[model samples]
Target: MCVYLLRGIAFSKDDSIPKTGKAAIENKLLAEAVLESIIGKKGVSPGARLSLAERLSQLMKENKVEKDATKTDNQDEANDVSLGDKLAKEN
Candidate 1:
């Protein structure tokens, strides 16, 4: 997930975070990086890793950052209806 780090933010399917040694984590990207770091580490407890997503979400809320913007209207619109359903309705 560190590979997907955008401007210091990184994420992955497993969830993790990156370390900012000697530096203050001030950017929203840090949340992503943090997730990446968690994914890279070994032997992380299930409860601890599960907390990562919630923690990142809290941080984003505190910073007034909206992640919903990552999704586009067009993308969701396409999924609004199944192809078979649409075709049946059209017929």
Candidate 2:
């Protein structure tokens, strides 16, 4: 079921859609939502669902790491500007 959905998504990826950046992120979110829903449905064992949940958690963690890295880079740039201002004021 997941494979079929993935294949459909892959086939749908064409010139009509943006393939990188925000579009890519949106696609990933959609895929994750679909998988989560499937795993959350009836008939799946708790252990198997737990494994899927762990994978989802890891995925979210990776995304947070990327966002944190970007935020850190921005903060560094801001700090550099502030530091330069301090030095100028001391001069």
Candidate 3:
């Protein structure tokens, strides 16, 4: 599933990333590309790409770990990011 997700994201080597086997690294680069694609759309450097990738990877890991440790039975009944939050952030 992890590999499938990475493949779907298309961060594999020869894409927009340097030669690396780390999926999260690739995922981060892919994410940056999306962001740049929205705004500047310029290619980011290797260092920035790797750093962003690492940070994003850590965030994803933390989110998963938190979710796994959370109780399933009727918690807050709200997500971490709600529609209200999204609208507020957008504004």
Candidate 2 achieves a global lDDT of: 0.51
Instruction: Return whichever of 1 and 3 wins on lDDT.
Output: 1
Candidate 1 per-residue lDDT, tens place, 1-77, comes to 32223334333456555544334467667765665555446523444455545666777796665656555579787
lDDT of each: 0.54, 0.51, 0.53
By lDDT rank, best first, the candidates go: 1, 3, 2
1-91: candidate 3 lDDT, tens digit per residue: 1112333333434335534455453476876566465333254445444545675688899999999887466556544577888899999
TM-score of each predicted structure versus truth: 0.25, 0.35, 0.34
Model 1 scores a C-alpha lDDT of 0.54
Q: Cα deviation of 81 in candidate 1 (Å)? A: 40
Tell me the tens digit of each residue's lDDT in model 2 across 1-91.
Answer: 1112212222223324324332232476776675455455662445546644665688889999998776654656756667768899999
Q: Once superposed on the true structure, which residue ranges of model 2 sit more than 4 Å away at CA? A: 1-38, 72-91
The ten-residue window of minimal lDDT in model 1 covers 1-10
Clashes of each: 15, 0, 1
Clashes of 3: 1
Shift of residue 90 alpha carbon in model 2, Å: 39
TM-score of 1: 0.25
**Cα displacement (Å) at residue 79, model 3:** 17
